[model samples]
Target: MADIKVIIPAYNEVDSIAHVVNELPKSVSEVIVVNNNSSDNTVKNAETAGATVITELRKGYGYACLKGLEYIASKSKQPDIIVFIDGDYSDYPEELDNVVAPILEDDIDFVVGARRKNLREEGSMTPQQVFGNWLATFLMRLFFGAKFTDLGPFRAIKYDKLKELNMEDKTYGWTVEMQLKILKKKMTYTEVPVRYKRRIGISKVSGTVKGSIFAGIKILGWIFKYSIK
Candidate 1:
């Protein structure tokens, strides 16, 4: 079994997927890219980069992630750790080591790569993104008593424990769902600061006003839904 397997969920990210895949640490045994019905050449690019590609006809982030998990579960030798990263190249691929190191050392079951706001490129995030992150994280801390900053896509978690969470968010709530489930399970979790940069393409969420509002509602709703349970 591989020590670590990185899974990237991509939708129309042909421009950035190859770079993200190629830059990953060689220590990572395999790179899996979930092509979420992208119209572009995302799969071809990922394949060209020597990444294992899986096509998920679904059009949502959660769907892509679920498909990736299913692929991993069917592997002959399951990886000890699974890392989730965005295919847009917004996150620093080099920092993947930091996210998985804690798990390999048995320090935590989940590790979130929190983007250092000051280090992120200017305009890389919209106002709604900034406020949504702050508000949602604050609510989680107040209600669920979990500490987290930006719920960016870059994260790592143990494979077995992740399955126990039974994640089911189908949209932008994916990140919050994972975090809330881990907290509810009382699993060890930690956050490490990571660098963020501008993505090659525009974001699907937080790029427009309507998308941000909907995302915020879904995230907050999930937090409260899981907390009251």
Candidate 2:
């Protein structure tokens, strides 16, 4: 069995973090929740729910994720796989088994849990978010002949393959950066359909006009920058 670890980047998700932690499959070896400077009960809740909680003073999604990676690196034994998921309870954490199945069963390098329209709850995704995913994925397909459809947060990858990507995005561009690098490296990857629902509280990114606009710019910037390279 592959030693699997999950990293959850939470920002003020106090209302939902515990549920997210409790629902993960038993196969997961560890659940690491990175509280991204949340001034709430997120840390307490996650710890109560049996997750190894860590704090990221920097308030970016990538910052929290990188913090988790650093913690894993400092451990005596490293996990064979790493899974990234949101702490908003929007994704079905129990489906973690499915998220990493491709990597375990087929020797795949990376797997993304695609939030398909049919499986997603009504209003789970905002219009801007929907359009952003479409535009970003379309650009990727046009530029690199890629088959990615959604920049979903629920995803998994092999530890060694993840290290090779040398991830550096510290904010809204993290997801796209990973996908772009996977394409650049010609790594084996696939997408698994996953159910999605409305998050418990307002989203830090898609719920605000400013956050949405900045996220779009960051995503596009990475795509265009990589296309030229």
Candidate 1 lDDT (Cα, 0 to 1):
0.90
Candidate 2 displacement at residue 48 in angstroms: 0.2
Q: Weakest 10 consecutive residues, lDDT, candidate 1?
A: 98-107
Every candidate's lDDT: 0.90, 0.97
Query: What TM-score do all the candidates reach, one by one?
Result: 0.96, 0.99
Q: Encode model 1's per-residue lDDT on 11-113: one tens digit a residue.
A: 9999999999999988899999999999999999999999999999978899999999999888798888889999999998988988887887766899999
What C-alpha lDDT, on a 0 to 100 scale, does residue 187 get in candidate 2?
Answer: 100
Native-structure RMSD, model 2: 0.5
